[model samples]
Target chain A: MTTLLTDPATTGAHRADTTHPSVSPADAVRQTMTMAWRATLKMRRNGEQFFDVTIQPILFTAMFAFIFGGAIAGDVGSYLPLMIPGILAQTTLTACMATGVQLREDMDKGVFDRFKSLPIARIAPLAGPMVADLLRYGIAATLTFLMGLLMGYRPGGGVLGVIAGAVLAMIAGWSLAWVFAWVGTIGRSAQGVQGISMMIMFPLTFLSNAFVPVETLPGWLAAFVQVNPVSHVVSAIRDLANTGTLTAEVGWALAACAIVVAIFAPLSVAAFRRRM
Target chain B: MYAVTTSPTPPTTSAVRTEGLVKAFGGRRAVDGIDLEVFPGEIFGVLGPNGAGKTTVLRMLATLLAIDEGRAEIFGVDVRERPHVVRQLIGLTGQYASVDENLTATENLVLFGRLQGLRRADARGTAARLLDRFGLGDAASRPISQFSGGMRRRLDLAASLITRPPLIFLDEPTTGLDPRTRGQMWDTIRELVDDGATVLLTTQYLDEADQLADRIAVIDAGRKVAEGTPDELKSSVGDSSLHLLLADPTQLAAAAETVRRQLGGEPVLTPERGRITVPLERADRAADVLTALRTAGISLSSMSVQKPSLDEVFLALTGHDTHSETQETAA
Candidate 1:
């Protein structure tokens, strides 16, 4: 054993003088893409990851169209327009919660320990998964709209408008995911992150105008819903999908998304660095 | 091939140095205060029971945990002030495998290589070569979830070696592996040193330190209690001893007297087991004592020369068994 280990050819030949180069902006982007690619491969292999964006959107859209369509909007036909945008907003936002849950799971499993020791940019691991999750949001948004179309709902906004609505929803989801990513860094476990995220998301999506028109809700409850950022997102998607026109709500939603990214991106990175 | 560069640079002389290093969780100090100097091209073993702060010290050095107090430097790079540079000099394998179970072995290696700044094609080529070198070529495409404990560990070690960093930290690398696999890991570590890398290895197993470490530090309660070579440690405990169990209980006194006359030392006798034990000045003296006992018409059940076990050395230094303490901390 000693003779084998002492063989210089087997050992010294592999030794390369590794230089520590300062991480540039371009390197950071490449490293983030590497991590994002890993996340994408994981999502592909894990069938459960697709269950949310695929089955949940299809099921929720059908359940809302059949169960609450006539009672809320007088028929399924009119409800498709209302429910499609609402479900798109809800499904995409809900999908963001998985980002935190998976991050926490990765941390608990000690995967971040390897990343923490690496010389790459600190933000790559946190930001990479969020970038990959844009695909989940895209799937949820597209499926919700397709389910709406299957139910005979037509958007006057044309194909371009519906596509615009899906893109907007996906962007909103990506921004919201940063909040969950922050929670993931500080949370004790995946289950804990999921619990906390669900508590925050349930009220944000359910109580907003995503489900019902604000006027029909009680005045006090309706007031809170109108101010909810999720309501702005739902209203923006409704405008884009229903009328195919850019509206003021889209500006408010974009501002909200920008504000979220600006605040939580640094917060998440800070929390991540502290933990390391 | 890289020749053995004998640069007398100060940084190359010491791969790791820590002074008064301390880490605490809440109000409890996990690593009270540690002082370590691991020179280049040598394997330094930190031997301790679980929760004795071995992992804590390694984690701090690896820059995975912040140093609450004191200082740590890796090849002259301050771990706290310039962590990125320290990271470039070191590779760390945590107590856990730390590899992604969801990803295949190839993917995990490629991902680490890319993160370390290798181009995509270079990363893939490195991954393939490492997989082959580590004997994982056939299982390279399989997800780590399907791997056995030993395979996962090999992959984890291979992942850390992707960049061939000058310094490596392995925290209980063979803690959960079987003996055969642990032997393989020890060889791998020795091979690393042969390639001109310095290693700081933390282990709870005493034989592991004796087998691999050029020097060992025995730590308990987050402090170093003893530091020496394995031979120095064993000799410090006591001289080697000869132990004999008599086949006939009635001949115990006769056998003790013969051992005393021949070996010039009194034999401690245990009446219940009909056993006699005598410390020897030289290990070869055991043969002379055995012949004298037989000449006295004493029949023995068994006789053997025994050196002090690490458990005895640990007991002499810390007044407790390391194995039990490890179990307590694990519990």
Candidate 2:
């Protein structure tokens, strides 16, 4: 076989104006957004799986509210505002695991290997998947709240308070996604990621006061529950929904969210940088 | 600019060059001290076996993996210093189809073009042009999962070429395809080279390397054993082979040992089949070998002399057959 070598002089003259084509930070951000959007679009094509987020949240929220509202509190009204926020927080965070699982799937299927070879942003694949996952969490959180409202769980918090509760939950979901992304990057397979993520999340969600008050627990358990980040977030949401109050606890919960993002965002990017 | 010619003149602006690249995983070296110079519009083949570190070399060249030692340059830009610049001038298609199976072929191509910074309309145009070029126009709307292996491979290749990158890395581009599809892919690759695009190809198929490579580099166990044109490497080990098949199944081992003792090299035993093969440098060596066999009373079922293949050259240099190992791993 004969391969014709192009005239370097011609290419040099043509590329002189181009100089060095480098991926600027702004371009990296744009590429990340584009990659994330593409990933979400692919997920939407199936359309069947979207119901997992939209319908699961609504069904789980309403079922948990009705089932627990009577047995635990003996009255539905007494727990509507309290339980809705807890359910919303719990449901959204659980949905965040899908982000890591999907990433593991992509890696196993060699999608990231392809991206590594392309002239795109270094963090596009990692950042893009995280960004796209926000949409899933957002949809799940919104549907849960709407179902709560339809079932007569009027948030004592006004629209602003309701938005604040949702915003906190959204940020919590997004921040938590970074941790899962890191796990997914290092985990061997999607099944391994699922097992590890579930193990990590089960303790966090169940140990926190998602279903009951922390004071009712044993002294040692209460100490663990109080320090748990999920408890802070749940308490913050409960405060917003039940009394529409932005207490010091809520401020602390926001700090915790920032802290998780601070730690895991860079870690996820660094881990993802080597995944290819 | 499009119709280039093969010339010995070194390009003043090389598309990509490597100097003593080295990479290792968990203390096992994959690419060790390989030097390559890829000029614009040339298809340079890195021909090696399954674990010869071809993919590692390609990955490092594409800036996917970091260099452990030495330097790599892409379009005059230092790869270690400005990886983004190196990435901009290159495209890569891995051994497997890397398309998102959930998306349609058209969607996959358009998305890739968009990632390359093409405008929405231009991305779509590029997608359409590529689909048409690869005979995937009609199936553009179908999800990639629904396509056959050949169709998926075509889409995969098309997606890589979306930006018309000046340099491309195609790692085992035609593995697992039927002969007809493989030929189609060859034509497509030739078209790219003809259009003044430089390509660096890596393959285990000797024919693939011979059919496409302007210069071939044969690697063994993370090191380059020999590097030259196909003819040069084949002729280096001579052009003939002498194969002996023992009539008595029990005598096969003795014959092989006898051949090894006479030839001063270990003869290859085709597993489970009763045959021993050795490289022949001259035709008269066959007569000498036959005389020795008669004196030793080694009976043969069949004996023949034929031209040496690239496989023989590979075995002569590496002491292992590439096909048998890959078949074992695949099984």
True contacts kept of 2: 0.33
Q: Indicate the worst ten consecutive residues by lDDT in candidate 2 chain B.
A: B1-10
CA shift of B140, model 2, Å? 0.9
Best by lDDT: 1
**Cα misplacement distance, residue B323 of candidate 1 (Å):** 5.5
Query: DockQ numbers for every candidate?
Result: 0.38, 0.21
lDDT of 1 by residue, A198-258 (tens): 9989999999998788889998899899888899999999999899989999999999999
Q: Lowest-scoring 10 consecutive residues by lDDT in candidate 1 chain A? A: A1-10
- TM-score for each predicted model, relative to the true structure: 0.92, 0.82
lDDT of 1 at B18: 95
RMSD of each: 4.4, 7.8
Residue B172, candidate 1: alpha-carbon lDDT: 92
Pairs with steric clashes in candidate 2? none
Error of 1 at B299 (Å): 4.5
Docking class of 2: incorrect
